[model samples]
Target: MIGKWLDIGPTTQIEPGSARTLPVFGGEEIAVFHTVRGEFYALVNKCPHKAGPLSQGIIHGDSVTCPLHNWRISLRTGEALGEDKGCTPTIPLKIDGGRIFLLREAVVA
Candidate 1:
């Protein structure tokens, strides 16, 4: 568990059923999303293609559509769907008492 607690503002920053980008650890961005099931997920904000910000992407169910080139990445597995190649790193997020926390390092599988 290379997990580290990353402070990404308050829990309210990520609206329910929505995703947002957070800047931490030397300006590295992380995309935080709250599922309709009330579960939280976090991933690298940069897309594998052209380094697009995945946080600005749209959330459709358990997938996120990269805003840069319409590439879709799974919020759960960080695997690019459709015609995309390569996978983005994912950080595990655990929120406790209104403070959003994430692992300092991402795990790419």
Candidate 2:
């Protein structure tokens, strides 16, 4: 399914500065985010620091702060910011006709 897109849902389902979760049957749970600036991003729901559910974390700009440890993660790169030293996995996403899609392979692999 290379180059294929998996339609998650419409953009408006997730409010600005918030996120929604998509569960993969046998894979990792994903967090789809809509930034206050109207940008969209997707990452593995887990935080790099303590595996906190990022979908439950607070979004600010292009970063998300882990709710458990308050570690900030870069939404664009999935890197733990500041004194942190870990990285989460980011999923490739695109917005088309107000719908959100994730790369098919990336979502399952």
Candidate 3:
């Protein structure tokens, strides 16, 4: 089924080169980041290494270095930067009229 877009907050809620964590329906958190290059990406906030909150991480280029262990993961593709075969899931995001929207049906693995 298709899900509707959820208004997260104003686009300014997440600045360029910064990230924000939004609460979801099932006790899960979603991390939304806007790269310094002005691209929006979303993914599950939990890191696969030690279950760290990825939203609290720092953005370096197109990758986010996990705050807990410094594990770098790609925000665009949800894949670990290096040395990992597994990856978290990415969510669908849309921006319109300076507001950020997140799709409710975020897929994870």
Each model's backbone clash number: 1, 0, 0
Candidate 2 per-residue C-alpha lDDT over 81-103 given as tens digits, one digit per residue, 9 for 90 to 100: 99899999999999999999999
lDDT of candidate 2?
Answer: 0.94
Worst 10 residues of 3 by lDDT: 100-109
Question: Evaluated with TM-score, which candidate comes out highest?
Answer: 2
lDDT of 2 at 70: 96
**Better-scoring candidate (TM-score), 1 or 3:** 3
Cα-based lDDT for every prediction: 0.78, 0.94, 0.84
TM-scores for every candidate against the unseen true structure? 0.77, 0.94, 0.87
lDDT of 3 by residue, 1-109 (tens): 4447777788887789998887777788888999998889999898878878988899998899989989999998888888865587889888889888887556321
lDDT of 1 by residue, 1-109 (tens): 4445656678777787788876665668777888777778888888888788887777888888878889898888989898678798888878889888876555222
lDDT of 3 at 102: 80
lDDT score of residue 25 within candidate 3: 71
